[model samples]
Target chain A: MKIAIVGSGAIGLYYGALLQRNGHEVAFLMRSDLEVAKRDGVRVIRTDDEFTLDRVAAFGDSEEIGVSDLVIVSIKATANQSLPKMLDPLVDETTQLLTLQNGLGNDQFLKARFPNNKVFGGLCFVCLNRIAPAVVKNFMKGSVSIGPSDGADASEAETLVSVFSEAGVKARFEPDLLGIQWKKLVWNVPFNGLAIAAGGVCTDVIVESPELCSEAKALMEEIMAAANQFGYTFRDGFADYQIEITQPMGPYRPSSMIDFVEGRPVEVEAIWGEPLRQAKAAGVAMPKLEMLYALLKRICK
Target chain B: MKIAIVGSGAIGLYYGALLQRNGHEVAFLMRSDLEVAKRDGVRVIRTDDEFTLDRVAAFGDSEEIGVSDLVIVSIKATANQSLPKMLDPLVDETTQLLTLQNGLGNDQFLKARFPNNKVFGGLCFVCLNRIAPAVVKNFMKGSVSIGPSDGADASEAETLVSVFSEAGVKARFEPDLLGIQWKKLVWNVPFNGLAIAAGGVCTDVIVESPELCSEAKALMEEIMAAANQFGYTFRDGFADYQIEITQPMGPYRPSSMIDFVEGRPVEVEAIWGEPLRQAKAAGVAMPKLEMLYALLKRICK
Candidate 1:
C-alpha cells in the first residue's frame, strides 16, 4: 500500500513509521522537517518498541507526493483551514483521505474539500508528542479509532484498520464515528479547555488542585448533557470514569495546552465552538460550555 | 480625629494620603512599606494633583499605633485572613472600621472579627496602582460608596464620608450597604474572574474581543439574575450599562489580573467563591460564575 501523511507531526510520523516498517511505501508531506526526514528518516520511541525508518520519501510541497492510496490528514485542527489548498494536490482517483485530527468537524471539512474522494475520520487514542524534528514520542500504547465518512463505503475503512492492527497499532473501526467523536468531546472540551484557560497546565496539574478537578468533572458533565441534547448519551459516572483514568497520567499536556505554551493559536473552534453552536441551535442549555468557548476564544487568539 | 490605615497598598495609601493632607493625625498600620513610608511619607500622583507627605507616622506592629477613631482596611482581599490579628490592636471604643477592598465578604469578615467596633464597607470607585514603595498612581477620581456593615447608625459612616469629601474625594453613605455590595458584585464577579481566567488581560482587552465582551455581558447578566434572587435587583440593561461604561477604560487590568500576574494567589473566595456558594445555597443557577470560580480556585492558589 502507498500512503501519504499530510502532516508530519507526531501522530502522522508515528503512524507513518509503523506503516513504513510494515513494508508500505510511505511519504511525508512536510514543512521544516522535509529535508531532515528524507536524509535521516523518522524516528519513533514507543513504550514497548522503538524503531527508525532508515530512508523514506519526503515532500515539502504536497503536489510532489501525488496519487497515493491513502492520504492521512493529520495536521493540527487549527491548520484545517488550509485543507482545500494543501490536500488538493495529493488526492487522486483511488486516494482515500483520512482525517486524524481533534475536535468535531474534521471529517465534514475534509470531505467537503475532497468531494470526489472518500474521506474517513481517524481518532488517535494515544498520548504522543514530537519532541524534536522528525522524532515522535509515544507516551503510551494506543489505537486508532477509524470510521467511514459520509459518501464513503464502510468496507473501505477495514483495509486501513487491518494494516494498522497488523502493525501493532490496535486499530479498530468505530461504526458509530459521530457518536465516538462526541464521546471523545466529553473528555476533550473540559480537560483541554481547563488546561489552556487555567494557566496552560497539564492534566496532572489540573487534578492536583481539588477545585480545578471538580470543575473538570463539572465541565465533563455539562458536555455530556449537551451531547444528550443532540441524541448522544453516555452512562452515569462516565465523567467520573474519565477523571479516574486521567488521574494516573501524571501531568499530561493536552494539545490545546501545548498550543498555548508554544504561543500558537488553539483549535477552540473545532473542539468547543462548533459543539457549542450545535447545542444552542438545538435549544440546549449549555452555559458551562458557552462560558468555556467564550473565554477560550479570547484567551487562545 | 486620629486615623490608622491598615493594609497600605494602593487604595490604602491613596486614601491615607488624602486624609493626611486634610489635617488629620493619620498613622499607617503597615507591613513591607512601613519603613519607607516613615522615612519619606506616603506619596500619591493623582490625575489632578500629586504630593508627597514629608512627615507621616508608620508602624509595622499594629500594637504600636494603639487605638484610633478610624481604621481603614485597605489591603488586598487575599490578605484579609490577617485582619483579626493585625487590626485587633488598632481598634478602640469609638474606632469605626472601614473595609475598602475588592470582592464580596470583607465587611462580613471584618465585622465578625471586630464585633465591638462599628464597621463600614467602602467601595472605592477609582482606578489606582502602587507604582513604587510608598507612591500610588491614581488613574481616575471617583466617589467612595460608604455603608454601615451591621445595621449600625448611618452616621457612623458619615464621619469618614465627611473626611473623604473634605479631602476632595466624593463620598456618600448608602442606607442599604449590603445592597450596594451585591450591586458591586454584579460587575466584580465577571470582570475579575474573566481577567484572571482569560489570560490576565485587562478590561479593555476583554472588550476588544467581541466574543469575550459579549460573554462578559452574559456573565454579568447571570450574576444580576443571581443577585435578583436575593432581592437586589437592578434596572433593565444594567449589564449593558456596565459594558458601555467599561469599554472606554482602555485595557485596564482589574485587581485579579494584577494578582495573577504578580504571582499572588487570587482572592477567589471573597470575590467568586463566596458569591457562588451563596447563589447555590439560594437555589439560584449561576453556572457561568460557578465555572469561573472553579477554574480560578485552581489557577490562583
Candidate 2:
C-alpha cells in the first residue's frame, strides 16, 4: 500500500515508520523540522523496539509529494484551519483521508474541505511525545479507531484496519464513529483540560485531592450528559475507564500543560471550546467543563 | 497603648513596625526570622517612605512578651490550629485579640481558645508580600475591618478603631462583623481556591476565560446563597466588589498559587472545606463552593 503521512510529528512518524518497516511503501509530507529527519532519518523508540530508517523520503512542501492510497492528517488541532491548504496536493479521488488528531471538530473540518474524499475519523489512544526532531517516544500501548465520518461505507475503515494491522498497530472499525470521537473527547475534556488548568499530573491530582477527583468526575459527567442530550449513549463507565487509564500514567503532564509551560498556542478551542459550544447549543449546562475551558482559553490567550 | 504582634510574617511585621513608628510601643512575638530584626531592627518599604527601625523589640517566646492591651494575630490560616498555645501568655483579663488572617474560622478558633477575652474579627484589604525577613513590600493600600465576632458589643470595636488609627493603619469598626467576614469569605472562597486549583494568576483565569469567570462568579453566588440560608444579609454588590477588586490586581498570583509553586501545605480546609462543611450541615447545597473545596483538598493532598 502506498501511504503518505501528513504533518509528520511523533504520531505521524510513528505510524509512517511502522508501516514502512512492514514492507509498505510510506513517505512523510512534513512542513517544519524535516531537515533533522532528512539528516538523521526517523528514529522511533518504542517499549519493545528501537529502530531508525535512514533513507525515508521527507518533504517540506506537500505539493512535492504526489497523492497516495492513504493520507493520514495528524497535525495538532490548532493547525486544522490551515489543513485544507496544506494537504491540497495530496488529495485525489481515491485517496482516503484519515484525521488522527485530538479534540472535536477536526473530522468536520476535513469533511467540509474534502466532501468526497472518503474522510474518516481516526483516534489514537496512546501516549506519544516527540522527544526531538524525528524522534518519537511511546509511553503507552493502545489501539486506534477508524470509521467513516459521514457514516456511509466501511471500505475505507477496512483498508485502514488492514494497513495498520500489517504494521503491528491494532486498528478497529466502529460504525458509530461520532460516538467513538465523543468518547475520546470525553477522556480529553476532563483529564487533559483539568490537568492543564490545574498544572499537575493526573494521578497526582486524583490522589492528592478528593475534591479534584470528584470535580474531574463531575466534568466528565457533564460532558457525558451533553453527549447524551445529543442522543449519543456512551458505554457504561466510560468516565471511570478514562480516570483509570490516566491514573497509572504517573506524574505525566498532559500536552496542554506542556503547551502552557512552553508558552505555545494550545488547542483550547478544539478540545474544550467546541464541545462547550455544542453543549450550549444543546441546552446542557456544564459548569465544571465550562470553567475548565474558560480557564484554559484565558491562559492560552 | 502597649501592643503585641503575634506571628510576624509580612503583614504582622509591616503593621507592627508602622504602629511602633507611630509611638504606640509595638512589639513582635516572632519565630526564628526575627533574630535579624532584633539585631538590625525592622525595615518597611512603603510607596511614600522607606525607613529602617533601629530599636525594635523581637521575642521568640510568647511568654517573654507578657500581657498587652491589644494583640494582633497575623498568621496564615494553617497556623490557626496552634494559635491558642501561641496566644496563651499574651491574654489577661482586659486583653483584646484581633485576628487579621485570611479564610474563615480564625475568629471561631480564637474565641474557642479564649472565651473570656474580647476577640475581634479583622480583615485586611491591603496587598503586601514579604520581600525578606522583617521587610514588607506594600503593593496596595486598603482598609481593615475590626468588629465583634458574636455581634454583641461596640466598646471593643471602638478601641480597635482608635488603636488602628493611632498606628496609621486604616481600620473600620463594623457593627456587623459577621457580615464583613462573610463578604471577605466570598472573595477568598472563589479567587483563592480557583487561583490555586488553576495554578495560574487570578487575572489570567478571569480575563482569559469567561467560563472560568462565570464559574468563579457562580461559586461566589453559591457562597452568598449559603449565607442567605443562614439568615445573613450580605451588602448589595459584594460579589461585584470582589470582581472589581480582584481584576485590577493584574496577573498577581495569590498565596495559594505560591503554596502550590513552592510545594508548601495549603490552607484549603480552612478556606473552602470548613465553609462547605458548614453549608452542608445547614442543608444548603453550595455546589460551586463544594466543588471548589473538593478540588482544592484533592490537589493539596
- Which lDDT tens digits does candidate 2 get at residues B1-301? 7889997887898888888888887879888567888888988887788889888989988888888888999877887777778788888978988888877788888888888878888888787777787887776768888888773368868877877787788888887776676667787777777777665465556644566677778888888887887667767887777778877777766666766666877888777887788878988877677556665665676
Question: What TM-score does candidate 2 get on C-alpha atoms?
Answer: 0.88
Model 2 chain A lowest lDDT segment of ten: A199-208
Candidate 1: give the clashing pairs: B204-B251
Best by TM-score: 1
Candidate 1: deviation at residue A72, Å? 0.7
What lDDT is reached at residue B263 by model 1? 91
In order of appearance, the predictions have TM-scores of 0.94, 0.88
Candidate 1 on A1-301: residue-level lDDT in tens? 8899988888889898988888889889888788888788899997777888889888888888878888888888888777778877777777888988888889998777778888898888788888888999988776788998877878888877898898778889877677778888887898899898887889998777777787788778777877787677788889889888888778888877887888877888999998888777878777788788888887887
A117: Cα error in model 2, Å: 2.1
Q: Which residue pairs clash in candidate 2?
A: A208-B298, A208-B301, A209-B298, A210-B298, A211-B294, A211-B295, A212-B295, A298-B208
